[model samples]
Target: MTVDEVVSRSDLSISSAHEENLRAGPQASRLGVLRRSFQREVHLDAGHVLAERGEAIEKANLVIDGFLLHTLHDGPKRAIVGVSLPGDIVGLSAFGIGSMGHSVVTAGPASVRQLEFPLFEELSARMPSIVLQMASLEAAVQRQWIANCQRLTAPQHIAHLFCEWRHRLARSNGMKQVVRTPFSQTDLGDMCGISAIHANRAVANLRNAGLAEIRRGDLYTSDWTELEKCARFDPSYLRAVRT
Candidate 1:
């Protein structure tokens, strides 16, 4: 559906986490001002490409639900640079840019609000704090991508990915430890830069170790401490500005 159509729809969903952030902060009034101009929410089916690489990112997106995988292509080689969870803003880097550096595709059935660049600029003009938050978020995402691509081993990457999701989902969903992930083994592989078969093996290993288990389309960790140790996870990359 078109942006205008989605905006007009009364049933359009908003990310509760995002709304809370905007409404609870010191810059609440400024954020609220910008939020009022937010565009309509759009729903995407799994595997749908929300924006393609090399195309100009006319708008930035606020994810309301599900995950978005950012994939970068180098000739025939494809690498997943990042995953956008609910309450995360995708394409912030493309703001004031020429084109998208990577293609964003839905990891599952997803919902997002598309904020056009012009409106984003307006938001920034009204409240620079929001822009700072976006910048901080983008930096955090890039740091994680660097670690996943260059520092972590295959198994460590998978474990770290899950741990990161747990923390993110917790912050967004009443600070819960269990994360509801709808991704398949292939999606896990993409995020971890491993093969689907390898992802399955890694998961099996984790399950055997009593660190994690996937049940009913959700991922639950029996012992987060052990899981973090197994992943060698460091939480510094996911921190946002406290203000």
Candidate 2:
């Protein structure tokens, strides 16, 4: 649905964690001004390409729902460099840059409000704090990506990935213990830098140890504390980026 449609429905609200930050902070009134400047909204189906590597980004998309996969392509091989959840902006780097280094694709059905690059540039110039916030978010995401590629065991890597998602979802949607993940084993492997077979084995290990289990697109943890221990997860980084 469109942003106009979303705004008209009393039951629906802009549920972006980033937008929530904009609302809760001193710049809350500024958010309304920014929303008024929105050009339109775009809806995407699974596997739809939102932005392509090396292509100029004309607009920045504010994710309203679902997930996006950021991928790096090398010859015929591709790696998932990041995953964008609701409340994240997809092309914020395009503020001054000509093109993006990686491609953004829909991981599932999703919707995003479009803001033209020129308008974003103008708005950001008037509000320097937004730029600072975006930079902090980029840094946080990069740090998490580096941590994911660290020398952790297969299960530890996979478990940590799930734990991160769990925390992210909770922050964005008030999601509790259960996480509704729409990723496949192959997708999970790509995100964790493991093979599909290895990912399967790691997931099984998590389940057998009573840590967590991914069943029918949902991740359930018997004990969140125990699961965090297995993953060596520190949620402080996630908290630090929030307003």
| lDDT leader | 2
Report residue 107 deviation for candidate 2 (angstroms): 0.7
Residues 113-193 of candidate 2: C-alpha lDDT, one tens digit per residue = 887676666666766776667667767867877876775788888788778888777755885888887788888888877
Query: Clashes in each model (backbone N, CA, C under 3 Å)?
Result: 0, 0
Please give the range of 10 consecutive residues that has the lowest summed lDDT in model 2: 3-12
Model-by-model lDDT, in order? 0.73, 0.75
Q: Superposing all C-alpha atoms, what RMSD in Å does each candidate have to the true structure?
A: 4.6, 4.8
Clash pairs detected, candidate 1:
none
Error of 1 at 124 (Å): 1.4
Model 2 gets an lDDT of 0.75
**Where does model 1 exceed 4 Å of error?**
1-25, 32-36, 215-217
TM per candidate comes to: 0.81, 0.85
